[model samples]
Each structure stands twice: as C-alpha cells, then as structure tokens.
Target chain A: MLYIHHSICISPQFTFPEVNLEELVRSTDHKLYAKLIVNPDIPPAMLRRMGKAVKLAVSASGPLLKQYQNLEGIIVGTANGGMEDCIKFLNQIIQYEEGVLTPTNFVQSTPNAIAAQIGFLSKNKGYNITHVHRGLAFENALLDAFMQLDDNPGHTYLVAGIDEISDYNFNIEYLCGYIKKEPVDNVHLYESNTHGSIAGEGVAAFVVNNNQKGAFSCVKALKMLHSTDKDEVEQAFKQFLSENLSDNKTVDLLLSGENGDSRYLDYYRLMEAAVPGAAIGRYKHLSGEYQTSSAFAVWLADYVLRQQQIPELIVKQHSGGNTIRNIVLYTNYQGLQHSFILLSKS
Target chain B: MKVFVTGMGIITSIGDSVESNRKALMEGCCGIGMLKGFSTRYAETLLFGEVKFTNEELRNMAGVNERGVSRTSLLALHAFKQAVSSASLSHEVISDSKTALIVGNTVGGMCLTDELYKDANQRDTGSEYVASYDCGSVGIFLQQKFGMKGIINTINTACSSSANAIMYGTRLIRKGYAKRVIVGGTDSLAKFTINGFNSLHILSSAHCSPFDANRSGLNLGEGAAFLVLESEEVRDNKKVLAEVKGYANTNDAYHPSTLSDTGDGPLLAMTKALEQAGLAPADIDFVNTHGTATENNDEVESRAMISLFNNKVPAFASTKSNVGHTLGASGAVEAVYCILNLLHQEVYPSLNFNAPIAGTGLIPVREYSKAPLDHIMSNSFGFGGNCSSLIFSRV
Candidate 1:
C-alpha cells in the first residue's frame, strides 16, 4: 500500500488553498478553464515563462516538494502537454516559413516539462518521468509511485496528473465531436443528453510515500483496464474489487466518473452495477471531463474520506459516508479506459 | 527472475531487418543524408536518418487499412510485427492477458500535425487524424490489432523514452505482472519536429560526429524498434539474444534542454545500473553512449564515462553515428544493436571522428573489430534531463 501524505488539487471550483467548496460552480461555456493559483515563492521571471499547465502543476505540489527535500522522484501524467506552446511554435514556423523563431515554446513543448520543472525548481535532480497514456495517464503515474515506494520503504515521491484546455482545444475537440459544442451547464451536464461531455481541465498533485505518518489515507490498490465492451468493464471492475480488497471489506463510498456523455453513460451504468448499494457519487459535473479527470476523483476520494461528507457532489450522497472507511473510485474515460482505486482510512 | 531478450526488430535509415542493419554497422555505413518520405523544405538543406519507405508503402506492408494512421504508428506496426514473428509467438499468446505492451514515444500523431492543424484551423467536420493524435494512440492501435489485454502504457521522456519503456517492461516481467512484454518506441520525420529543432538551432548541417572536439549538433532521425522481452521462466525454447542485466533512470534537473557539465545524471544512472547488475564497470565490454553529437551531450557523456570507469573507459561508440539520433526510438534501437554485438562477439565503429575533445580526449571505436564481448551498456539521455542506462549481458 502507498501512503498519501498530501493531495492538493486546483480546478475551476477552487479545490485547493483549503477553500470551502460549499456551492459547486459551473462553466457558462463548454470549456472549463482552471483559475491558476500561482506560487509567490517561484520567481516571477521563471513563472512568466511556464505555460498554464506547468505553472499550476508546480504550484499545486510546490509546498510538498519543498518540505520533502530528498524526494525519490517526481512523476507526472499528462495527455496534452503544453500543446498550446507547441502549436504556437508551429504557427511561428508557418508564419515565418521557418525563418524567425524563439526556442521557448519548443523547450516547454515536451510532455516531461511538467515533472522536470518541479525538479528544476526543487533542484532535487532525481528520477523524473512522465506518462501520457490518455485516460490511464494518472493511474500509471500513481502506479509508478506506488511501485517505487513499495520497492524502497519510507521513500517519498511526488506524483501528479495534469491537463489544461487552451482557447483552441475546445474547437479542435469539437471538430471530432469529442466535446460538446454548445455551452454546458456543468451543473446540469446529464440533463442535456448531449453527444459529448464538456471540455474541462485541472491538475491534482499528491505526495505519496512508504511512510504513513500523518497521511490522510492509504492507496490500498490500483487497477486499470482497457476495454471496448460494457460487459467486459463490468466483469473487470467486479474482479478488481474482489482481488484488491482484503478481508472482504465493503466499499463505503463509490465515486462514478459519469460525465453524462451520451456515448459513454452506458459504461458508467455498468460500473455502477458492479458495486450495488454503495454510496454512489459523481465528480465530472464539478470538474467536467478531461483525460486525467480521474485525478479529480482521487482528490475527492481523499476529501470524502476525511470530511465525512460529499462536497456538493452530484446525486447528493447516495447512501452514507458518516463512518466511511473504504472509498472506491471507479473512473472510465471515453468508454475505453477504466480504472479502480481502493482508498482506505488507515 | 531475469528478463531475456527473446526477439527484436528494427526499422531505421540503415536498414529494416537485423541482418541488414548489422551489415551496415559492420561496414561503418552512415545513413544520414537528405530527408526523404515527405515533402519538406529541409529536404534541400538538412540531413535526416529517414527510412527508405514512404507512409503508404509502410501501411501496405503492414496491411493496415485504418484511415489516418500516422507514419509513427506505421513504423511501430512494422517493427512490432517483425518482432512478434521473430519470437515465434502465436497470435493467441500475444493477445493473452499475461502479455503487456509498452511504447515509448515523444512524437505521436503530431507527425501529422499538419493535417491536425488543417482540421483544427478549418474546423471542417473532424478528420480521421483527430483520433490518432493522443500519445496513447499508437499503443492503443497495437492493442486493438493484437487484442492485447494486459498492461498498456506509453512513456514520453523525450529521448530516453524507449529506454524507460524497456525498463518498465522488464519490471513488469520481474514483478510477475506479465509473462512476456513487448517494449520499444517509434517516431517519424515531421514538420513539427523539424521546425522545433530548427528553432532550437540544434540540427547539424552535416552528418553528426560523436565525441569529436568540434561536434556541431544532432541529425534528427526517424524510425522504430521493438523487442520482445520474456522472463527466463517463460522463454518457451526461444533463442536467448541477451539478458537484461541492469537498468536505471535519473534526472539532472539542472536545465530544461541541457545536461549539466558535471554529467551528474548520466553518472548516477550508469552507476546505479552497474550496481543493479551486480557488475563492476570493468565487467562491461562495450558502452553504447547516448552521443547525440550535440556540444553538450558528448562532453557531459564523456565526463560521466570517465568518472564511472575511473579513467579507463570501455570500448565506447555511438551507433547514432550510423542511424542518426532516432529520438524516442534510439534507446531500443541501440539496445538491439548491443544485443547483436553481444550475440556476434563484435563491436560497430562510430563514423566521422577526426579529433577528440580538449579535456576528455576520449575517442570512440573507429573500426569494426571481432572482440569477445560479454556485456554491453547502452545509454539514452533526453531533454528535461531524463537519463537512462541499460545493461545487456550475453546469456
């Protein structure tokens, strides 16, 4: 099991900086942009050069990285890594016909930039890596952290999941109809029965280690599956729950990543069926749908595990978290990637 | 549990099959030349290690009728099929839940970013290119094609990507997560990368010269390489090419695009790999250095070698001198090259070297020679200070 020391998330509803998410916020447009919370400690000069994802990524985990000086590593999972900067450079290339250009955008364009920036800022110079496997990105990063921590007991590591939407992102995703073109009332996302979900972006950073001292909870097990069939997903989730859970422990809170995308709600229904009578919850409404939106669900798992109540979540707490002990997060992205994380109150 | 390389395949500017590439390396042939397989203004000015086949030609060879598949995935599919066939693995075995697939890539469908941009800019009903842009798209395509149900992942640590992919595959087998794992990487010449490297001014005007005193820059190459890694327990009578003895990944964290002058990351990675292998530096017979031929890489790498080898560096060379720097694919390419050398008891020569650096004065192998080799160390370092080293020992 991996211990979660600090889990911080920055999203549109302001999940971080210890804000009280009393009333969930909704985006007037289909795209839900994150309000960046910059770190004052980072020099303005350095911060100016970082893209939105990089800036918020470092800010979300900056404190934990600083507190734990000798970290084993920083691993990040991202789908669209600074594509805004990359597209800007490509545009420069086209506009200049390969004549005039600056190297800033190109340097920040690589997907590892987020993890590397954290190391550059902390100057730890340890193992830094990035995984860009679409929906499974965060789960892979968490697995890396878990495996690393499991290998070396008591070692601390920083793991994060980040994806940001650019002004052009929604339009591009809209062309494929992967994102809804109409303005989405994230509050009433399921009511529209639209063909696609809203475009959203956020970053969640966690300090995971082998030590459980002062930790919020423990990541008991993590399982990921890639499938195109709803029945397969249902069976895989049932198998995952049975295999990962010890002592036949029952789930107290189960968060379903139902984004209300018409094409994918059936898979979500199947997932819900896998765990009957569990205290069901929904998060994509608050964070919208993105590649690593599962990270948002993880942060919520920690929140509900500690707060003893859901924070304005959809369905308004299905059964109970009054004495919640096991929080199972089952997230499916685009009906192809499925993940289950068993979080326990250690 | 030891990880053994049961089968491997590669497609590069040098050649596509193992034997052809071995012949080129033995003859000290250089594949860096005018770019081909695409329309780019750089075709007239810059050099690239582009494979001989065009995208359509590769798709036809791989029998992939899927629309909008990028050249990156095509090259990947080409190498992947060869590796699986060479391993004598059945379709059922490859599709089993005990088999894992991992691909390391920095360039995904962005090789077709031109089409992606056209689709995005025009917002004309979505193009097939949209479905191919994700970094995971390549692995997803392979999984769907083979029905692979095990762990599937992609690593994008710039140049060290495939080395990390190989490392992750080894870990999966060692941890019993899979009986066998296919790990490698792919990249194709893209206008996006050409312009990106051009803006950085790191594209060499001529063929790259590694460890040379005045090495200019890197020649961006395009290709793919894949290796079927199996646990010793599940070798299934397959010929053992080599044993994955040790590996390590470390970050310099000193700069975004440059390695530290001290070569701290490479030094640590090499040291850790040797420790894991339980082999001393002297046990290694040859070192396939990262040797991107950039002003920074050769110097930092040389410094690291001197420190690790205690001034008695092993016979070192950069096969990148033959295939040019294949970016994300270089690690696995060089690993397979090392396995070939280990299997043949020989070493390939580095091309275009006249003088040594001022202080290091370390020169790479200048000629092909038949030397009894037991272990080979392959190094791959990338942007963002990602450094990885793999140790391959004769089984």
Candidate 2:
C-alpha cells in the first residue's frame, strides 16, 4: 500500500498546513481564485521569477523535501499549465508581430515547469515526469507514483497537482459557457439553477512513501476512465469497488465532484446512488471548479481520514458516520476525464 | 513480463512514412531548409525542418475534416492510424478496455496562436479551437476519434515528453495495468515555439551541425511518431518490431533550461536504462544521441557519453542533423530510427560535422553504412532538465 506522509494544499479555503476548513469564504466574484499567501521562507530572487503555478507547487513541496531526505521521484500534474505565462508570451508575440520577444514568459510556459522547479530546488536527480490530461492529470500522477512505490518499497516520492487561472483564459472559458454568468456566493453554489460553474484554481502536493510510519492515509485503489455514458461509469465504479474494497465494509464517505453544473449533475447523482450508506460530501463549492480540483478532493479526503471529522460546510448529506475509515473520491471534467481514488485510514 | 514493440509509425520533414524516413536516412538527405508552409518574419532569417504540407493539406491527408483541429492533432492522428494499422489492431481491439493511449505533446492547439489570440481578445462567443488550447487536447481528440476506453494521458516535458510517455506506457504494461499501449508524441511548428526558441537565442541561422566544434544552434522541426507496445502475454502471433529492453528517466536538478557541465542527468538515465536491461554500456551497439546542436547540449551529452561508455564509445549519430529537433516528438521519432537501425543492421550518419568539440574529442558516424547491430540506445533530453534514455534490442 502507498501511504501519504504529507499533504499540502493551497485552495480557496484555509487548507494549507492543517485542515481548518470549517469557515466558508463566500466569493461575490464569478471567479473564486485561490488565496495562496506566499511563503516568506523562499528567497526573493527565486520567488520573483516564478509564476503563480510554479510558486504554489514549489512552496507546497519544498517543506516536505526538507523534512524528508531521500525523495526518489517527483511527478506533477497540471491541466492548463502556466497559462498566465503562456498568455503573456502570446500577447508579446501579438504586440511585437514576431519581432523580439521576451524569453522569461516563454521559458515558464511549458507544463513541466513545476516539476522541474521542484527538482531543481530539491537538487533531486531521480525519476521526474509531468502529466497534463485535464482532470485525470492528478490521478495519473498518483498512479505513476504508486507504480514506482510498488517497484521499490523503500523509496519516497513527491507528487503534486497545480493550475493557475489567468484573465485571458477565464474570459475565454466564460465565453465558452464554462463559467457562471453572474457572481454567486460559493457557499450556495450547488443551489444555483445555472448551467455553468464558478472558475477557480489552486495547487496541492503530497509526499508519498511505502512505509506507513507517519502516514495520514493509505491509498487503496485508483482508476481513471474516458467516457460519457452513465451506465459505463456505474459499471466501472462497481468493478473498482469490488476489486479494492473489502466485502464486509462499504465506503464511509463519498466525496463527489459536484460543481453545480446542471449538465453533469447526473454523474454525481449516479455516484450518490452507487454509495447509498456513505455520507455524501462535496468540495467544489469550497474550492470552486478547476481541471485538477480532484487533487483538493484527495487532500480533503486525507484530512477526513486522519482527523476523523468531516467539515460541516462541505457535508451534503450525513449518514451518521462518526468514524471515517474508507473514502471514495470521484471526479470528472466536462464529461471527458473521469477518475476514482480510494483512500483509507492508515 | 517483457515489453515488445509491435508497430511503429513516424512523420517527419524528411518523410511521412517509416520506409521513406529510412530511405532518406540511408541517403543522408537533410530536410532543414527555408520555411515554406508558414509565413513569419523569421521565415528567411532562420532555418526550420517544417513538414512540406499546409494545414488544410495535412487535414485532408489525415482524413480529418473537422474545423479547428490543430496541426498537432492532425499529425498525431495521421501517425496513429499508421501505427494501429501496422499493428493490425482491429477497431474492437483498439477500443478494448485493456488498451491505453499515452501521448506527449508540447504544443497543442496553440499552433493556431493567432486564432487563439483573436478569440481571447474578442471572446467571439469562443471558437472550436478554444477548447483545444491545452496540451491534453490532442490526446482528447484522439481518444474521441478512436473511441478509446482505457487510460488516456498526455505528457509535456518538452523534448523528452515522448520518451517519458513510452517509458510510462511500458511500465503500465509491465505492471499489468494495460495489455497493450499506443505511445508516442506529436509537435507542430508554430510561432509560439519559433519565437520562444528564438528569444532564447538558440535558433540556428543555418542547418544545425550537431556535435561539431562550431555548431551554432538547433533548427526547430515538427512531426509525430507512434509505437505500439504490447506485453509478452499479448504478443501471441503479433509481428514484433523490436524488444523494448530498457528505459529510464532522470532530472538534472541543476538548471531549468540547461544541463550541468557534468551531464549528471544523462549519465544516470543511460546507466539506469542499461542496468534495467541487465546489460553493460558495452552491450549497446550504437547510440542515438540527442545532439540538439546547442553548445551546452552537445558538450554535456558528449561528456556523458564518454563517461558512461568508459571512453569506448559505440557507433552513434544524431538523426537531429537530418530531421532537425522535433521537440516533443523527437524522442519517439528517434526511437523509431533506432528500431530501424536494429532491424536493418545499418548505421545512419550524423550530417555536417567538420571538427569535434574542443575537450571531449568525440567524433560521430559521418557516413551511412551497414553494420551488424543487436542493441541500440536513443537519448532525448528536454527543457527542465528532463532526460530520458531508451534501449531497443533485437527480438
């Protein structure tokens, strides 16, 4: 089993070093951007050059690298990586019309910049990779780390997921009907009878290892699918549960990716029906909606499994579960990339 | 649990098919020249290895009639069709739940940089290309087109993207997650990359001469390549192209855009790959060097090669000299060339080399010749210090 030793998240809520997500920070703006206060420990020289995504990723994983000695690998996932820089570079191109362009923005625009930054800072010479498959990005990164752990049980791995919102991207997505037309309180996000969800972004990182010494949670199984059919999703969920979960106990908490988009409500409804006895919880309202928001969901699941307390603000429906043991996290992006991550108490 | 290559496909400036690429390699034909397909201010100033086709022509060639499909996805579909057909994978087999698709792409729909800029500016109710901007869009398009039901992912580690994809796919098969995997990478020339490389002052004014003392810089290229990898259990009656003996990936952890002078990342990757294959450095018959023609890359790679091979380097050449640097697709394209080298028992020469680097004193194969080959290694190092090496052996 792969154990999550450290989990760090820079979400909209106050979920950084510890889980203090009881208070809800409602946003009046259409985009509920992450409130990631910069870590002062980073050098000013390096901090000035990093984009928001790279900053969040490096800050979240830096402390863990210092705490641990032998990190054998670094894997990261980002759907629309370094969009701010990409947009900046594109604007320079348009302004200059293919003339002299700045290289800094272009250098930071690639998707693997986060992983590379982490590796550079840690001075780690090991297996390093990056995944960018929309919502499945985080899951794919976790799966890659799990496979690495399966190969060498003694090595530690740093896995992270990061994405940042840019004004250009937000405006384009808004025009594409991916974001809500008007601002609404994020606390009441699910009650809005709208076709689109709010836009948000953040970064999350986890230090995973095979040893369960100080692990917060143990990952049981992770599965990803690319399908839009409801029946196929349900069937895959059933198969996944049967293969990973024990016959005696069912899922304790069902963390669903319900981003208040009516088009995808049926997926969450199916997930709710699939896990009848589990307490249903939603995280998109707190974190808003992003491509790799499932990383936040995983971080939240780790918190619940370790702390044994579900935040009342995120609880959609309670099934009288005082002691949380097994949690099933389900997420899908625009009906394209679907993933399921099963976590349990260590 | 051995991973075997069942099929291979590639589309480069030198050729559109594997056979054509092989023929061009044997003849030492250089594809780098003045850009003709796209118009830019640097069109005359800098050299590029652009595929000799327009966007519309590529769309028609790939049989993709859909509007707003990026050139990257078109090239991917074209090469993917070839790979699957060569593998004799039926539609039913390709769409099987046990089949997976992993692609590496650095430039996605951004190839339409002007269109994206206009769309973002006007917000013109968004266009078909709006959703295709991300790196994952290429894989999503392919997955939708082929009705792929298994795991679909995209890796974007710059030039090493496809090499890591191939490595990840092989690991998935070895771990029993997938029975068969279609792994490769695609990248198309765009103003975004051209200006990016140019701004970095790494674009060559002339055709790049890799490993040469006076090598100026690299000529940007565009293309796609795919290889169908299957586990030993699924290799029943399938024609094996080559055996994926070993692979490894390592980060330099020293610099973001350049490698250390010691070439630690490349050395580790080569050593680990050889270790995984249960072979020593001497077992490798030839080496497909990254050889981006940049000063740092050529020198560092030469140092790494000398250190790893213990001063007894094997016959090697950088196909980049012929095809230019294909960025994300370079790794897979070079891997296909390596397979061809093993299959045909031939060594393709590195083009335009007058003198070796000052200290390393390394000389690459200067002429194409037939040689008895058993195992060959391909190296792909990218931005962010991502270095990957793959070794393919005779089956």
Candidate 3:
C-alpha cells in the first residue's frame, strides 16, 4: 500500500528531472568528483544553507510537499549525513581557535537537519526520523514509513535518502581504495576490472501514501540481507519470485548497484541469472555510488513503470515486454549491505 | 502493539541508578549545581548538572582497563550493563537472535577526539579509540558487553536521538524484527559539546529554571538511560515497568539551532502521539516536558503544551531542574522519569519557578504531588527542530 506519489534525484550526471535521466546515462564516461545540483533560480542565501545532499533533498521533497499540503511524517536516510558540513565546522574550530564559526554551517552539520529544514520551510510537522545505518539506512526508513502507513491508513509520509561526497570523504576513500583509479565507459561498468568503483553522490525522496491515487507503481516487497552471500541472494531472489511475482515469466527490467568491483559483481550476476530474460540496467555509472543511492533505483523503477518505456541507454535488452510492468532492484554497499526491492505496476 | 518495558536503568545528576533516581523523584530533590566536574575558565559563568564521576571513577565502576575505551563508551557500557543485568537476560540470552542493541548518542567519543588532538604521540588512527567516533562504538560496545550480536544500531539525530531510537526499536519489534531490544541513549560531558553549546551562547550561567520568568538558558548535563523493550511474548517473564503506548517524531526545520517561535513541529508531534494512543489531551494526567531551560526552548515548549491542552494543561514539571539537559539521553531519561511518575503516582517539582511566563499561563508542578496517573506524556525536542513525544501508560 506504500505508493510513491513523487520522487526526485540529484547526481553528478544530469539526472534531475525525468528528461535528464537519459542524458545522464548517455554521458557517463568520466569520473564525477562532486555532484552539485545546479539550480539557477534559487537565491544564493538559500543555496548557501544547503550542502549537496540538502539541495537534492529539497528539490525532490519540494514537489511532494506541494502535492500533499500536510505531511504526517518525515523520515530521512543517510550513510554519512552532513559529514561535509561537519568537517567544515570542525576545521574552522580547529584552525580558528573557536573564534567565530558561523552557526549556520554548524547547525546544518547534523544529519537530521535536512528533514528539519524541509519541515520548517513547508510548515508541515507530524513525525520525523533520521536513519544512518550505512546502506540499510534508506531501507530502515522505508520500512518505518511503510509500517506507519499500514498502522494509519490515508496518511502521507515523506521519506528521503541522501548522501554527499566531501573532499575529506574522497580522500579517505582514496586512501582506503574505495574509489576507482581508472575511469571507464558507463555501458561497460561490469566489464571494467578495477579495484574500486567510482564514488558518487545523490539524494532521492518519495511521498509515500496508502491511498494509491494515479500512481505508477507500488512497492511490492522490500527485503534486506544481513549475512547474505551470492547463494543467499539467489535463494532469496527465487523465493521472492515464487511468492510475489506469481506470473513467473520474467521481470521487465532489473536495476542494480553494479559498481564495477569484481568481488561485488557476483551478487548482481546471481540476480541476473535468476531473472533470465529481464533487461539488465546499471546506474552507478551515472549516479556513482553512495549509501542510499538505491533510492535512485526506486525512482528509476517508478519512472519506467509509469512511462512504459526504457531509455535506450539503460536498456540492456529489448526482448522483455515493451510495456514495462515489473522491476526488481538489487542494491548493496561493498557487498555487505544487500537488499532486494520489488516494484510493480498498479 | 503491546510493547512492555521489562527493565530500566539510568545514570544522572540526581542518581546513579534507578533506585536512587526514584528516591530523589519521590522526595522532590534537585541535583543542579555549579560546574565541578572539570576545571573550566568559564566555571564562574556557567552551572551544570554534570555527573560527578571522573573518567577513572567510571572505569573503576565498569572494571575496564584504562586507555582502552573512550569516556563516552565507558558511560554507555555502565548504563547498558545495568539495564541488561536488570532484565536478567545477560547469560540466558546472549545467543538470542531476537535480542538487539540500539543506542542513541550525540557525541561519539568526542573526548577521545579531543585527547587525540592534544597528545600527538598518543593519537593513532589504527586504535579503536579513533574508530569509535563512527557512532557505531556504542552499539559495538553493548554487543560485546553482553556478547549478543543481533540487530545493532545507533541513532544520532542531535537531542531527540534516543526518543527516535526508542520509537524505531518499538517499530522493529512490532514488525517482528526483534523480540526484545535494549533501547536507550547515553552521552558524557565533553569539552566538545559543552564548548559547542557554549559557543552558541545558549548555555546558562546559573541553574536552569525551566518555564520560569527569569529563565536565561539551559544548563548542560550528561548521562545515560536504558530500557528493555520486550515483545508481548517475553513481557510475562519479567515485571512490566510500563507500556510505551504511543510515540511520534516531527521536524521543525525552522532554524538549525533555534526553534520556531510558534512551536509548530513540537505541537504536531505531541498531538499525533496523543492521537495514536487513542487519548485526548484530557486523558493525560501528567506531562514530562523537554524544558531545556533555554529562553526560546522553554517558552516554545510551554506554548506547545498550552495549545495542545487548550489552556487546561496537565500537571507538568521539568526534571531538568534536577539533572540539567542531558542532550540525547534526555528523552529516554525523561521517559523513565515519566514511567516512574506513573508507577508511584507522584509528580516532581520544577525548581526555581516563581511566576509563569508572560503570554503562556502554564505553571509546572512546583512541589511533589501524589496523584493517580493513568497516562503520562513525555516530550523531547532537539536542536535540529527534531521533536518527539512518547506516551507511557501503567500496565
């Protein structure tokens, strides 16, 4: 019953609106250092208050807030929420002797500040929560919202997953070998034999409600893996297919968090092996990799389900149904934070 | 839907454990004091309800090796150990997959972070001390403390962190994720948070008088509290302290540090929590408010309470008068205070209150009162405009 009324994403690629998804996917050859959402009209004062993740959340959550006048609850997911702002303020305090660090920067440094900012600006307040459990952060928030929706029908919840790449973050990842040294083409992500995948940034939000009004799709099921291996994923995927996807034929499209790490590729390959005839699509090329970027997959699933068309750049095959009906998304962080989400047309 | 508290533990200025806290609350004693835990140049200017225990004292209490864990982790381990033992689930449930540890913390070993900054040779990135700042240390410590490794997590949404942690723990249990969860929050007095709030100029130079006319600002305190939340199946084995009937979280987003003058987010959270409990404003017999004693916080909280009760506000008091603002643990600590109120049918006084504020005519309990209480509402509001209300009913 959790219907995604609206969703928005901001990444290094040009994937802001629905139209930009194709453009972003088509032009994903280069490594994106920082993904700052470009909004020309918003005044500098407002923009200064937002970090990369905050901007993306605002843009995505704005449309949802406009659609629903009252928000019953707000839940946010982030792996490293506002770490950029934290570094900024801490650097100031360490370097400036605690003289006059701007309160604005320090205030937004907290992870939940994004939700608080949205609630304050929209003047909608009911319930607000922030999750920071690495990749499962978004899943936990989604689960909480789904439970809330189930408990109280006919209420809308704003759920957002956000994370940004900071200079410190990039340096640490580089030191830890979490980012790729060699850049590769977007279409050949799985083919690239690299030690690490490119680190990216993004924020995606959904206005979830039980009242499935002119919605494109519904969240069929969400399952997270704690001690999952390739075999576990395969078994879980088969279980999900048999129980939820009763049709048993094939999923229309499969969006995956394929970050080009050979060690992590087995899970996605297992998923591909499960859904034999489904078209395979990868998003880390355009969106890069963050903790909650799987939210982007949910957005993509909703998009293809609503439009009934897959962008040529994302379509690995055309053999599946031309009119998209089902999407199964697989996401993980370093092969540890694995989750499978099933979405289908209403 | 019927989650019961099987065990409770708290460490605060008023008391070090549940029994002492109950005694102090029943006797209506206050624990606020001039800052004596550390040597502060601003010592004359600021008063705090800081825990009197030093790092060595806490380590001796926990019987842990020195220089092994951060002070923050030490305090957390203390409270978490007590809660786990009080629940009697220590040896019996170590391998229980249904048992999880969820902690709410704001400063994750900031004292260690500061020590590293001071001692160049002692600072080692490879050490567990530095890695503890990941905010997972509390969960990791709790896991090792009892040798239980189920669902481990931490909530760090500033002040309302523990309230949200409790909320998520209940939801996870209700959804069958876990059968029992050791859920609570902990924070230690650190130069980092103390200086951080001090830099914001919201730290009071005197005792915090929540909702009082002369209230200037908050007096920062630090401590921990833990409650064992059990599924209905496990509640019968242990005495049910109270039931977490309803809870809600809302964000104000008005300002990063300051709350909105209208208190919209807090009002919504309280109203929704009451509604979820299937109770009206009149049903609440007493209210434990998040009166941080800040100029804006107390006034805004007072306004929210008045608007929610429509001028017929329940008998209320800010236990912060005794413990100061304990940051993230404030929610869970105050929640235990509310449960204690329901159990004993006593209302503790809000100290240093002479007259009500100008516009908001609400008056907190100035002395101890014994009354039959059915339901009590506890409010916890954080700096990020993160507001939460948890309602507890006597079982």
Which candidate should be chosen as best, given lDDT against the real structure? 2
Evaluated at residue A296, the lDDT of candidate 3 is: 76
Ranking by lDDT: 2, 1, 3
Backbone clashes in model 1 = 0
Encode model 3's per-residue lDDT on B1-395: one tens digit a residue: 69988888888888888889889877767777776766544556777777778878888998987354776787777777778778787665844768876788877665564443432222113344543554545666656556563566677778989998898888888988789998999887765566678778888887788898888888888889998899888776688889989988877767778888999878988998988789999999998999888889889989888899998888999998889888878888998898889878788888888778998877899878889999999998897788889999998
RMSD of each: 1.3, 1.1, 4.1
lDDT of 2 by residue, B37-151 (tens): 7778889999999888888888888888777789999999888999999999999989998999999999998889888887777655777788888889899999999899988
User: Least accurate stretch of 10 residues (summed lDDT) in model 1 chain A?
Assistant: A312-321
TM-score of 3: 0.87
Clashes of each: 0, 0, 4
A1-346 per-residue lDDT for model 3 (tens digits): 5898777766666656534665644324234543555455456798788777677677767777777887787888876677677666666656666565566666676777777767766776667777776667788778778888877798888898888877655654554456666766555666788777776778778888887777778888877655446786678678877877877556888887888888787787788888887888877877777778888788778878888878666665555467778888988676656778888887
Stronger candidate by lDDT (1 vs 2):
2
Considering just the first chain, candidate 1 attains a TM-score of: 0.96
The stretch of ten residues in a row with the least summed lDDT in candidate 2 chain A is A25-34
Instruction: List residue ranges in candidate 2 displaced over 4 A.
Output: none
For candidate 2, write residues A1-346 as lDDT tens digits. Answer: 7899998898878887655787887765767677877777788998887888988888788778889868998999998778888988998998989888878889898988889988988889999999998878889999999889988889999998888888887877777788887667687789987888888888889999889898879888999999989889988988889899879878999999999888889888988898888999999888888888989999889988888998888899999767898999999888777899999999
DockQ of each: 0.70, 0.80, 0.27
Model 2: residue B34 alpha-carbon error in angstroms: 1.2
Best by DockQ: 2
Candidate 1, DockQ score (0 to 1): 0.70
